[model samples]
Target: MADLLDRRQRLAAALCLAAIDLPANAVAAGRQLMQAASVCPGVTMDEIPTNSRREALTKARDILNELISEASAP
Candidate 1:
């Protein structure tokens, strides 16, 4: 969906903001980014119901925000 893709893009941009300074936990941050990027279902999983997909995206966004905050911390 366009909305999900847009949110994904926004989240990716936010994640890149952390890379600007290259945080001490760069590897962890990279991992989190990968997790955040995996909004779609995996090979083992069946197609996600529409509502479940929306919920997953929301959870990913929340995780992205936490990563951004941690990256911004002094």
Candidate 2:
């Protein structure tokens, strides 16, 4: 479970970085970020061991919030 979440977080970070690196004219970059951002809430909602749940949810929410802020940034 931890491995899965770690992979997902890494993938999300990579997507966000990719989006940031894209040319201003690349609409698909924003789409990619949005796609990654979309998964975060679901990740937060996923059932996990009680001991890990809060930390997982918090991380997911933080990533989601950061993605949102990045998307809205000029």
Candidate 3:
């Protein structure tokens, strides 16, 4: 269960990166978002402010990194 949750978090990070317009990957991101929306009926996307996206990405990255480092600790 923990592994599955971790994978989801990783996916979130990837989605956020793609949403942030990481060059050359916009198409991939668009496809992913569409797939997600399909699975999650009625789940829609909103055009949030740039700063909000940056903040979310930063917080998610920090949490993911901390969890990974803890799992790797001796």
Model 2, 1-74: lDDT tens digits are: 34455445654553443334323445765565456556544433122212333443555567777767876999
Worst 10 residues of 2 by lDDT: 44-53
Q: lDDT scores for all predictions?
A: 0.44, 0.48, 0.52
lDDT of 3 at 20: 52
Pairs that collide in candidate 1 are none
Q: Model 1 over residues 25-73: C-alpha lDDT tens digits?
A: 6677556445534643231112211233344455446767776787699
lDDT digits (tens) for residues 1-74 of candidate 3: 33445544554554354345334366775785666544433443542223444654765577678887988999
| Model 2, residue 15: C-alpha shift (Å) | 15
Best-fitting candidate, measured by TM-score? Answer: 3
Model 1 scores a C-alpha lDDT of 0.44
Clashes of 3: 0
Task: List TM-score per model, in order.
Answer: 0.33, 0.34, 0.37
Query: What's model 1's lDDT at 13?
Result: 42
Q: Predict model 3's lDDT versus the native.
A: 0.52
Those runs of model 2 whose alpha carbons end farther than 4 Å from true positions after fitting are: 1-51
Clashes of 1: 0
